[model samples]
Target: MKANNKRDVNVSKFDTATKTIHVFVALCDNQYQGIVPVPKTIGNGQDPDNNLYWGCANGIRSYFKKSKEWKLLKTQKLDKIRMERLVFKHVSKNYYLVADAYDGQYIKKTTTDFLYSAAGLLKDTIKINKTTIGINGNAKMVAYIGHDGLMDFQLNENFSNADGKQRDAIILACISKKYFAPHLSQAKANPLLWTTGLMAPEAYTLHDALSSYIAGGTADQIRTKGAMAYTKFQKCSLKASKNLLVTGY
Candidate 1:
């Protein structure tokens, strides 16, 4: 068996539509330096951590900070990828979605290889925080109904187990009307303000849902309920100033 090195690593990674969160670290002379965050400024002042990207940034930082085998090289932000605006007549099928922020396209309808995208940009958005204790994301709803949380509805333990299967079921619940919004009090006012129809992608990848939002309306501007975000994208030119960019960023 190969021995695993726990202390350090050096690698390039993509973290945004404009660039990857690429960082290199090593243990050359046995000294330590703090980890580097991304350049949220993109083209301006000192880089901000907001752009290091979430989810994958944590462990990657921890790995190099402790390892004695890796060292920092260079972190480069790529030209933004521009993807083709994807429109779903009715979400007839699932397809791959890619980012193209810098290239000018911003989005590509990978499903066209098959067919379809979003039908709405309405913002009844729900984000599941799985990092919470047993059954994060209020996913227990699946088990509460008396199912196994997976293959069976009665297996309640699975929902509280953090088992991969349980997580999948919980995510599926978010997209369904079954996961009704509890009366979350006023404190949860809204950080993703002005952004509509923003659903967490789960294992699907955020790139899949970007265009839906990049094309939708703001919380304060939701003139139409049940209005589709994708169709809304068509209402405004890509050049139209979006008030939601402040929150989405």
Candidate 2:
């Protein structure tokens, strides 16, 4: 509950016609996070230049930059907790993607922020050209990508819905469905895509899922897209991938 010195953008003054997708990614840290250790070079969370979940080939930033459907619009350096931010616009859709790379040491904060967004408690906006994009609570979809910190720590506060916005949520973490179910239910957010068991939280899954979402796919279709991406990249069976990545309760 420390004071948040950061200021939220005045969303009322800007254009709110475009849809947005906000993604919160916690960098991989071998030292600070609780999990099987990764190679030191890529596991240094503070070093985003080579971090496993931020700058690596399969990471969100790099993967999205290479995607044909998304065009990188901006990159900004943030504070200590949120190390970096990147904004992208979908090529053929009126949608914006805002992604934050949280330092691995602040994974708890990232998790809290994601939950806050899902519950419509964290309202933040950004300006892109003439459009003002809602990157937090006002976003159409909120996504979390990183280690399942819920497995290591417990959250005492309830993430109840604050505005009844009913945002869609995508959690790309190990066993995310089980860990995030109760909180997501309390937040009144629709479970668009989440995991049932341990899996690699890579960018391909999210990239394809978002593609399907942009194509106006339903929740089940989005989940199927994610499963197909996982199966293709991880070399796992489509059935196993479908079982691992599921939608709904």
Candidate 3:
């Protein structure tokens, strides 16, 4: 913003793509004495949709934009990598888990093929792809990450709306969520239908549903994360024959 409390702001991720928060840095202004920046929401519009980003009376926009600190806060930055790649790619592929840095997590692999996919998922992060899940675990505890679809959360947004054959695919997504909620008794813990895609309903109270879920987390100790919190696995690793993996949408 300029000195007279006026500044032009473009409201789009691309608009601010170059903007990054550095550790131990801050952007401060006088109007709103000690303003804290609220991270903008990630969009869920299918190729082209957006919620409005307007200014608040007390220069809410100006203050938050100007105020920043050196270190990023916990919960400060939400939605890192996702889970679709985990369930569809590795587990569905029968691959093993290798490390991934972009998501600051891991991918999967076991044999050479599985190893290679995991390698691609983390090609930039690691050199040699050597990893596998040595410890046996229950499939019930496994979680799959899906790409963001909350904007289309309404039941009307069906498979054909997706980029693929999508009939079975869309049904599977809805079924998966419904399945996990009851099976794991985690209807409450489900991450937003999309990850880091929207703000809490603007006027809701803390006791409102979002607050509760955010506080305790969605009930499972070993809950599955579908969109943001889930793991990235490939399906083919499981089959002796190669197959296509449709990561969740």
Candidate 4:
């Protein structure tokens, strides 16, 4: 795996004081993606303000911003591939969350970036309150949210673990346990939360799981929190949600 050309040598400087969570969200695309089509208005990937995964009522930005645990810090417009970025800080914990919304057309890049981050091959830094914080590969937890691009295309790049340090990963895609198994193992990441079958990849599940995670809950406990959230929002049975939202290999 290739590392970022301009690396931040001081990325680990604040590791003891703060932890980072980096999330890559591929905006929902009705035309470019292979999933069953959604309504035209919200499925437009280029328009992050209305995209299903980024801007909708249940989207990451909207939902996380409304949470009492996370305080929205900054919002920035990025380049073409990555449309927007949101930074949030935990109100009670020394944790920072950075989420990037990738253009719908660049789902492949989003998936690749998540895998690279999980492998600890792509490290980067961001400044908050004049303090440099590690992101990407330096994040303690890396997550991929949106359509399962692996179901549409294959990746040729090797995502082997670049650093021996183990990181936690959350994949909120349909049947991710099956499709992401090989690459995830190669990346040597612990699966904190993932799905087993086709399901909606919404923000509630991630938010709830993080709530438990921040409270020092075990993997199974965190998974239960996510499952309960999914059940509450999706109006599904607890058994079904539990089966869908799983943790571990």
Q: Summarize candidate 1's per-residue lDDT along 52-149 as a digit string, tens digits.
A: 21112322223222223333232234333211111111122121121111110111111111001010010011111221111112111110100011
Clashing pairs in 4: none
> Tens digit of lDDT per residue, candidate 3, span 190-230?
12221122222111111122122323444221122221112
Per-candidate TM-scores read 0.17, 0.95, 0.17, 0.97
Clashes of each: 42, 0, 42, 0
What is the C-alpha lDDT profile of model 2 across 37-94, one tens digit per residue?
Answer: 9999999999887988889999999999999999999999989889999999999899
What lDDT tens digits, residue by residue, belong to model 4 across residues 77-164?
8799989999999999999999999999999999999999999888888888876778888888999999999998999899899879
Candidate 1's C-alpha runs over 4 A off are 1-180, 183-217, 220-249
Ranked by lDDT from best down, the candidates are 4, 2, 1, 3
Best by lDDT: 4
Q: lDDT of candidate 4 vs native?
A: 0.91
Best by TM-score: 4
lDDT of 3: 0.18
Candidate 3 segments exceeding 4 Å error: 1-38, 41-142, 145-176, 179-249
What value does the lDDT take at residue 1 in candidate 3? 13
Q: What C-alpha lDDT values do all the predictions have?
A: 0.19, 0.90, 0.18, 0.91
